[model samples]
Target: MTNEKVDVVIVGAGASGSVYASVLAKAGKKVVLLESGPDWQLTDLISSEIWGRRVKPAGAPILLEGKNPMAYAAQGGWGVGGAALHYYANFPRLLPTDFRMKSEHGRGHDWPIAYEDVAPFYDKVAREIGVSGDARAEEKWRPAGEAYPMPPMKTFRNGNIWLKAFEASGIPMVPAPVGMNSVEFKGRPACLYDGWCHVGCPIGALANPQVTYLGEARKAGAEVRAWSTVTRVLTNPAGTRVTGVEYYDDKHQKQTQEASVVLLAAWSAQNPRLLLNSATDKHPKGLGNASGLVGHFMMSHHVASTWAMFDEDVQNHMGTIAVQYMSYERYPKKSHDGAFGSSFVTAGFAVKTTDLANSRADLYGPELADYMKRAARNLAGIKTFGEEQPNVENRVELASEKDEFGMPLGRLIHSFDSDAVALWNANFEEGLNVARASGAKEAWSARGTMPTSHLLGGTIMGTSAANSVVNSYGQSHELPNLWVAGPGIFPTEGASNPTFTIFALSQRGAERMASQWGTLTN
Candidate 1:
């Protein structure tokens, strides 16, 4: 049977897809957004950590095989907001140097577009999303942009302690620009700073797509189909364009939804996996694999933390579960002594009693309880983040085994280079110094066990189709109507948090599609 057609079909209801849906719907285009997970509401957001586990994608587990295997589910969100539901809302712009990775640094791939191209969108998204920060504090490292709409969130005692420590070490610590409501901008309430951002925010204080763009799209008459897993992008006879998508509905029945244009915003790992799985006889490798780089260069940032046992009670759980202060002293390659690349440092991290107890393997029962009690009152820490240079060997290829949906699962293969290891080690020492300066009686550093949520560069964008999957507009090189959004399109993994960049890129992509599709005038 012939399927219902729309002006645009966006796969994934996360930040990028939701933003695209909102823009198109407001521009008077008919839009249908398909999500692999269920639709979530404000009330559905539970404050408990146990309940937060249910918010991640579990439809089918992604198979990981690498020296540093990514915790795919931990980094991905399942419901309407996608992974943004669990994100801490730390939004920072990529510097001008990030776009010219190869030309300037002779490492990583250069972006098809420049910082100037995406800067306006960054300002637009920051205002729309209600970021709270002192832009003047970030002026040294921040790209040219408008000041934040809201003042930076109040620094807690923990932040004050860390800031002094950072300052003593000659490290420049500035207020973190986070996409969180400091004083109720755009009808959203101010953040209470309950310190549960790693879970889900129930009050709409943080700018999850469910409360921001997706909410606007719903009001603008965009249709969102949750629990709808898109299986393939159906191509035209010439294999020159996408006609629609085939997906399994909530009821487990297969259905087709036709559209003039199709956008994939599923996520980094999944976006490339979907394209690779849609290989047809006409395009044996994959629809967009003519360049043979669809799933190559999959990269995630490396994070390591230094824990301190302080003499005073800093109350680490009192404020937002975000980086309150940051130092970009080593962000430029020329600024650091060791390593080919550089890293940034964040002030402090949120902690819980159970999480601390579980870390010490030697303690159990009463001993665990005693240690947790002492740790809760005296423990504090700072985390350092490093950039990952894209490597061809680091990728997501389809596994031989298929999931229940008749699609091949992705087998991720990733490894950090010597430069990356050196970068992490260099920053790790700096973090310990900062912790010790915070008046810690003892300080220890450890490598992060799991992968952070910053996933980038699977179907990366570049000037040449020979080196990339999409153009700067996020449109597939081979198929004009097929677009890919989200962090997966990043040509190089910048040192800053990626949510803001992703938002800006998606807005630019949607505007480009609108201009080309002639839907804005329609």
Candidate 2:
């Protein structure tokens, strides 16, 4: 087996890991980033959904089970940029109440840290990432923070129609906080508004990891080794400190890279999967699984769609995808009324004829073409996002089967609580009302689908080792030298998208690591 060493060895080159690598390397630390996928360049990205599929995780097969199986392929990525390459960049911060869910609403579990603890990092990350938004427009309920780096993106006809409907319905809608550049900043060009975000941003207008922190990390002397699939985190005999990580290199050969500190910023699934698979006699469950909670508390957002056919052509495909506008009329804990969790609605996108045809299933050649023509000119869609409460029963487990690499595969099982279901129903109805209020001849609700990208919990952070795998700083309670970054440390799923919070926490975690480096290594 090949052997190498570094001061810090990071697994995954996604949004969180890239940020940590950038920070640590800039601090003059010897850093090595191991990514399971191939290294991607900005030029490699294209504006085709089919091509975008190639970027998703292909390291191993994962078994998904539950009423709503995790949309693994759509939610994960394999290249150096990780899943952020295909993200829509809807960057909304977590509400203050989101952190104290259990204490404030007596519903979900509480986070070990509070919103104030992470707000500065939020500001720092937003400025670094070049967010475009109007804090004042986000309404009086928005948590305090610096104004967005750039003004909000110009709203198109779709947003105008959506705003009118929201006003008619007495729902508050605001310019979406997006990570795409409204005006050129940091040498990256302004967005073309080509409306291909789901397919990945071909240009550098969007702040995907490849164009942002990965480049910063490289400039700071961090080395990124792509096509390295880490199978386990090795530890010392006492199992109280991380020794290194074991992985399969590009040639499918076994390799070991020793490090003083090991950071796992792989997404929620793989982070816990690697941790659980690293079990040893000293730590019988897993490296950081002393509480037997390595792969528990899985959470995902509930999403439903409402579509309407307007008399006028809306050109819904003209602007950014999933980054136009958002309505937070129902996003606060105190405003829930009878609904159990926070929820919000965002403007949706134009549809392809084939997709609409598939949805219509019964139509033939002529009828399908006719409906497609009408939908192409007149259709408008909106999607609702609702928070999920953490449940122990919703988890990721090791499957009986093994992958081609001979590692135990991940099995995801999740089910929404009754309250979550109620919240989704309420949001779905509201979506219909918003559409109808927009003066649609017809409006209908589509069954809610779970977003694979926003998955949280599993290896959650908490107050102590008795009930948590990591502390608030993402430090393992069992292994001091091991740290977990990203949404995996989240205690509960907040209603807003998790990308901004992930960046903020990663920044905080990186600073914490840099501050403790001398003492920990010595």
Could you estimate the TM-score for every candidate? 0.96, 0.96
- Tens-place lDDT per residue, model 1, 312-424, is 88777777877788877778875556686757778755666544664454578899888787788677777777888999898989998988898998888878887778878
Please provide, for model 2 over 120-158, each residue's C-alpha lDDT reduced to its tens digit, 9 standing for 90 to 100.
998898889799988778847666678989998877775
The lDDT of each candidate is 0.83, 0.83
- How close to the true structure is residue 478 of candidate 1, measured as C-alpha lDDT? 83
Candidate 2 backbone collisions, by pair: none
Collision pairs in model 1:
none
Instruction: TM-score for candidate 1, please give it.
Output: 0.96
Where does the lowest 10-residue lDDT sum fall in candidate 2?
350-359
Residue 299, model 2, lDDT? 92
**Model 2 C-alpha lDDT versus the unseen true structure:** 0.83
